[model samples]
Target: MSELRKKWITAPLLKLIKKVLPPISETEREAMEAGEVWWDAQLLSGKPDWDQLLSMGPPQLSEEEQAFLDGPVEELCRMVDDWKISFEDRDISPEIWEFLKKERFFGIIIPKEYGGLGFSPTAHGEIVTKVSTRSTCVGVTVMVPNSLGPGELLMAHGTDEQKQYYLPRLADGREIPCFGLTSPEAGSDAAAMVDRGVVCYGDYKGEKTLGMRVDWHKRYITLGPVATVLGLAFKLYDPDHLLGDKEALGITVALVPTDTEGVTIGQRHLPAMQAFQNGPNWGVDVFIPMEWIIGGRENVGRGWYMLMSALAAGRGISLPSLSTGGAKMAARTTGAYARIREQFGIPIGKFEGVQRRLAEIASVAYVLDSAHKTTTRALDAGHKPAVVTAIMKAHATHGLRQAINDAMDIHAGKGIMDGPLNYLGNVYRAVPVAITVEGANILTRSLMIFGQGAIRCHPYLFEEMLAAENPDTKEGVEALDKLLPKHMLFQVKTFIRGVFHGWTGGLFANSPRGVGYAAKYYRQMDRYSAVLTLVTEISLLSLGGGLKRKEQISGRLGDVLSQLYLLSCTLKRFKDDGSPREDRPLLEFAMRAGLHNIEVSLMEVFQNFPRRFLGQLMHFLAMPWGHSIRTASDRQSHACAELLMEPSETRDRLTRGVFLGNPGDGVDLVEQAFNKVCATESLRDKLKKGGIRAFNREAIDAGLERELISGEEAAELREAAEAVNMAIQVDHFDHLGTRES
Candidate 1:
């Protein structure tokens, strides 16, 4: 333990702070007792360990996996159109549901031995991204089963018998599974849940057996309406001590059959206009045998750990995929729409204002896609990056929010209009649902990412804290003695690196051999990393235990950490994807943007420090280096916009899986129209010079009649007009008729 840890353990200041600060809640207490350190916790120690990350490489997809994505997954996404089902039927059509079940869409993550397709995390992400681009409702339907639900929980913690019974049923979709974790009162603070299960002898199927009588009220459960089995998390109580002496066994997870007596399921919630089976469920006096307990009775009271672990594996995959999908869709569609839609006789994309937004949209899409791919690779490598997942979920959704807003700004009225022809509206409406789920962006940022991460990721911090709280004085001292020397050395190294990098602009930091401008980005990241380490140490030492209560400061620190991780991913992506020259501007923009955000976060940390003198001192230490960081230039923005304006192999690669068009919908009509208009540029210029600008169908016919232009010019002009008309079209639906009268 460093001096900070020593002080945290034995200092009078901590003791004083503990008294004045709010007491730790049950949730916090439970988390401490669980005592598992995650990957993010290690990174928070301020050391950049690139060996594992760099060595992992990009996620690989086998030929069969690729074929599955291109075949059944692609076909399934096309079949469930959000526009048709959202307002009219309010759920996926029966045919689509049956197809998903038969194709085992719900079992992508289960093991092959368990009768499901055992796919890599990368493949799972690809499937969700492709599906999300077409319909969020379908995406949620697919994601819930594969993510933090019973299937995952069972695989990780189920008894052999439980696995033998449940996994196959779940894998085959013979049992539709939904996990009830979030309650009406307990959202983020799940330890505060009121639902309870009591151990006692209860009549089950007319036989007296030792079981738990559970009563639970859960809301916002995905697939609740149609689920046949629900994985329920509740507080388990044993007042009679039927099996153990403990009265309470913390939080416990159990598999509850939805059709059992006293179980009520299927009260639906219409989230925005997008429809999926999301609803509330409750059970009164529901009896389940001890075997139903996940991981058997041995794992009782460990539900929080199980849920967190399950989330660690799957959380980083799903929502980030959805967000990246939205970004790709927005970039692809808005780029084409801006070119095809004309205002003042030129494409709206030509305007500088629109170009700025387009640049942001493209940049966001690129960065988010890069982050998603890189993080998923980490997951596939067997690292459960809990903090990374939290950061990705919060940050990617935020990026998606910005990308969608920019897309809407560029599309103007067309984006706001709700219809099948309007591609951007449904995604925009579903923004809240994405940001609010998994973990709300606010809590994830302010608490989970940095709050838990700072203690968890720091090399000696968790050990030191655990030792301090340990009852045996000799053991605590021995542990601290073991860690203290290394911790002190780490602090010394951090100090030297900070001063050296800060003074010389990272000139001494090792840069990869033969890399070009990206080398400077790597160096800049080094400088920021040094600064981040120094500040994190200073903040923890200065704030002590009270830092947990200071959410604003914690959130800013998280921002700094998250930006660094994202920048790292961006650089890795540039290298992993063959370092294409066309993507240089995007890479530049992403780096500058990340550095600017880090600088801002640093300033915020300094500004919000509880100790004014310490804040000023730290700001002085950060000095000219911190203040000198700049954002991407307008020229870079223009270059990014230009990349989006014209269709190229690069643009196509970036937006490859985005759903542009399918049969029965004119989705690609805009791209087709833009291509046609651009193809006849010579004729268009001649007509414009001849004072025949803004030609509609009638105007083109009139021009032909008067011989203002040749027959060929008129014919091409008519084609452009018709294509534009179809491209700008929006659907009209009868809202009242589609609803209950």
Candidate 2:
């Protein structure tokens, strides 16, 4: 056996493998090594253990966290005016800022031992969602400190003294913080940064001190204008070899006080007119003590890993929460408008075209909420999940953008006009901001999602790369001999499973015993998983190093993986929310859409593949019986739309956590009209039965006199009709843009 392995596997296999191995750059290698994998790795394994997914605890807030959201978060929302903040003020009020600091809103993730709220990851996401629903500007302000800013970095890698001193200050808002990582030349590529810091000796308060002379120019910083401290990233160099014999150090992080000499701040940039305190800042020959390094002097040249680790919080929690909030708000308000506003003597929502858009909005809301909840729950379970975080950031923002566009189409003139009553206009404007931040959607979808994930989540690819790169040829060959056989077996098994599942329509795929409504979805996802695994291996073998440059193929693969994850989240949400019969329409819509996307994305990849035979082979294995899944049916869409157009527990749960102010407000008016319309459904049917189609006040009075309806019922119907009319009216502003001055 050993002799057969030596000739057939060891020498020949190693030579071929080395020739096919892709070259990984320094930055790419660092990124692949940054965060640990979790459930994403399970899906890549082609046989996810359903028991593990079921074992994860559902996300829940503690009493203290719940109270904080109920009390202070609610108060903050009431204090905010989105129209005023976006247009007139361009920033939150002084009182709101003071309230946030006092309530520890900026320190939701900080531990209580410091001066913060110590909320769990789920609570933190909840706070962001609720606040963002009320005011995007204030939400950005609050989320920055709690997310990728100094507080998070400090908690992850700061020295003990740095934590003790800085955490309390950051928690109490004595020192507002911002992080600077994106230089002009390095928006998506941090390794291309030109910002620099040179190690040198400098005079401190009294004596000579060791520090770096740093110079940096960074833009798009969220809280740059008002930050008291800056978390800066710059390439480091030691020309004199001050700390080490090596001249160049990699990226390094430092904590520089904004008040220090040669530090710049106090300007703002209006991002998509959603105006938070975002701006650019500059540092010219700034001197800092060595202790100011985030993890101290010994931790120099490790800035990229630190930033990558800290990014999981913002990417996975804050932005996704904000997107979810916007989607839910759109679903609620658009549904209300569609029900009350009539055209051609009937509610527009009854029209098929309008129903399609409304259904899309509701399904997007449902899916975004589910993904947000599931990802945050994973974070609370102590998993960083870098690839999952990237997926969440890209897909949630994209979903929000889609939902907002559909909502605008449904709202028509009401959506076009901008005023205090325009609840959706600001969110629509903020869509680009969400898509552009954390990571640009284009770069993330094309490169980061699949490029990083393919190696990080794959079972044997990373090991093979390490083995191929080993310096000793004999050692590398031996390692590949062992790995090659196992890898080939895995590929063959996945291919067979893919072909069998595709032919049988996933009838034989595994499902959890008590999944109930979710059983079919589980089996479908398993079939897709096997297909994805088989295609991934074939593509790697066919494309090798060129796969990195084939971003279009990578992006399509990302879509399939993203849809699988979203579908999984939808199933999890159904079970966790008690699997209500009323919510089945939403579940069906989300699942069907996800499966269709997976099929379409795979087809697109196959069509564009470089290797013709492999592409055709993948197609046959993925869909042996031709296209089996189609988009959601119109019946399913109308059902989802009906849930939104009327008052039901399902609608209430889907739209929960958004701010609904007093009765006169836009959202409140819609809510009131929805309730009134639902209450009078049977009354309208009674009038129709009495042959009184158009029930004007006179007709209602006539019906009352004829005893077709009672006096109280006539009055109730008249009141309901009036409420619907009032709810359909949009606020009109004068040429000066003032509502009623």
Top model number, lDDT: 2
lDDT of 1 by residue, 356-419 (tens): 8998898899989988999888877777777788889999999999999999998888887766
State the C-alpha lDDT per candidate: 0.81, 0.86
Worst 10 residues of 1 by lDDT: 13-22
RMSD (CA, Å), candidate 2 to true, equals 2.0
Q: lDDT score, residue 249, model 1? A: 80
Cα deviation of 559, candidate 1, in Å:
0.6
- TM-score of each model, paired residue for residue: 0.94, 0.96
Overlapping backbone residue pairs in candidate 2 total 0
The residue ranges of model 2 lying beyond 4 angstroms of the native Cα positions read 1-12, 471-475, 689-710
